[model samples]
Target: MIETNVLTITQLEHRYGGVTVLAVPFFELARGRHALLLGPSGCGKSTLLHLLGAILTAQAGRIEIDGVDLAALAPRAADDWRGRHVGLLPQQLALVSSLCVRDNVLLPAYAAGLPADEQRAQALLAGLGLADKAHAMPHQLSGGQRQRVAIARAMYTQPRLLLADEPTANLDDRACATVVALLARQARDANASLLIASHDARLVAALPGAAVLRLPARGELPCAA
Candidate 1:
């Protein structure tokens, strides 16, 4: 039978310069579920996300996404796997300045060596209320619009897992709510599990019923809430 859980991690640990930065004994996110990774700025929230996204290989342990073991894949294979199975919304909103919003949303397709589906790109933008801005460059859009474009890009691959790092950072309360709502709606539409890593408390209320993993200050174990 196919596994219900889209993501699973066991005995996961990462280190930098001999310093243990993140460790999770076990964690799982079932398909279509949402979860929050809450912690202070330096508590390795981003490190965990990077590991899950396959941007960084773990020093030890296993990370399984959709029944595939990440540690078993080589660097090139891992990058391909991530492009297909994982969608990442980085805190930087790294939209390409030279590309139009539509093209920016298609970047993942090119990276994954998949055919560029302009229809899919336009549809995503429309869902995010950025249909009219598709032709506009990233610089021409507002901060929130840029974010929506990033979301569109991330969702273009219809990944089984969506990871957002500090999505609401630097946004005002109203903007934060809007961003969270957009993420929830988009993830739901894509039928993907959503995991957001952030220190923001507002998300707990914004995403009612989301599984929460609180990563304590460095050296403390992470716990579920």
Candidate 2:
């Protein structure tokens, strides 16, 4: 059976301060599958994730997430759409250090004018082995633990699309496996499509039938971002 496209891109062009970041002519992500975007640093992998998350506006071309034309939405509308259907885990994790782990997970829904479902959030955290850390602050957790919290936060809303940048960069082989497993399971449970940008070979190897997007080296035909 042919899976419906969860994300569709055509002639996606993006620039930052006059430097072209992405010039990918075509790309598509099928629903309920996990895809790996592989490339070295400065390869525009993260930039592409950002665009998909609607964090950055495309300079040209079309971006459709779950059949909605992203480029056509107003800035506020785009942000709302992101909160509603897209979960972005940037390289930084971007957790609010001041909030407890569970609160951080619930923040997204709160921002979107949706009621927080404590049961669902707790279930996701528990599945990630973070049930005991519900009240722990971000500063209290280890790197892997913090990363898991970020993942839980992304999965809390049951988004249709999940975009992660360098999700396993800091994890060891075993930890990487654990993280990928959790992400794959959650994405499937949520009926969401996951796109991850990472340089970690182990992480890519673990994903089932992952599609790779490798970027040309710097100055190699001026590969955009």
Candidate 3:
């Protein structure tokens, strides 16, 4: 998960319920560049994101990121790799309800066995306009604030690759634009590649220079990994 370069994938495929769900012939994203995984609801956009992030296994394929073969990694190794090298803003925005905003942002650092920096976490929140909410619990934050917290958490370790799933689906038009711009700017400043999997067409227009990785037709069946 940690290294130079962005991503490399070839002949990727996944299946569920005895049916093929995703297939990708080949794809790659360079470091500091942006990529969008565009597909319909059932086209396995989420599944492909999971596969690329080492959160799910594919039936057959090869995915190499930062010179590490994620598909070949052991489960613990995969988790370690993700913890150290990958930053993910999952579809669920999985924040701990009991943790304060600052603690939530530091979770990734703690998970990676690195020292959590209070000043850095505060800076991240302040930059994102959440400086005053640092001590607030997740339940007390608005949906948009929670999403920003998730983004801050994903960035605590300064990951090499940042992955997001349906990031703008729940926001209003104004908020959507704001979130997209924030994500692209932060990733660029951090020197991390940003990959967003979303069906929203607005994203393509919003991220002008982003490479698009549209998933293949959902008819590719292969044996499970």
Per-model C-alpha RMSD: 3.0, 1.9, 3.3
**Whole-model lDDT per candidate:** 0.89, 0.82, 0.86
Give a tens-digit lDDT track for model 3, residues 165-193.
Answer: 99999678888888899999878878888
Question: Which 10 residues in a row give candidate 1 its minimum summed lDDT?
Answer: 216-225
Clashing pairs in 1: none
| C-alpha RMSD of candidate 2 | 1.9
Least well predicted 10-residue stretch by lDDT in candidate 3: 216-225
Pitting candidate 1 against candidate 2, the one with the higher TM-score is 1
Candidate 2, overall lDDT? 0.82
How far does residue 58 in candidate 1 sit from its true spot (Å)?
0.4
For every model shown, what is its TM-score relative to the native structure? Answer: 0.93, 0.92, 0.90
- Candidate that scores best on lDDT: 1
Off by over 4 Å in 3: 1-5, 216-225
After superposition, candidate 1 runs with Cα above 4 Å error: 1-3, 219-225
Per-residue CA lDDT of model 2 for 20-135, tens digit only, reads 76677787777656788777777678888888888888998998977899899999998888888887777899999889999999988888878989888899899889999999
Ordered by TM-score, highest first, the candidates read 1, 2, 3
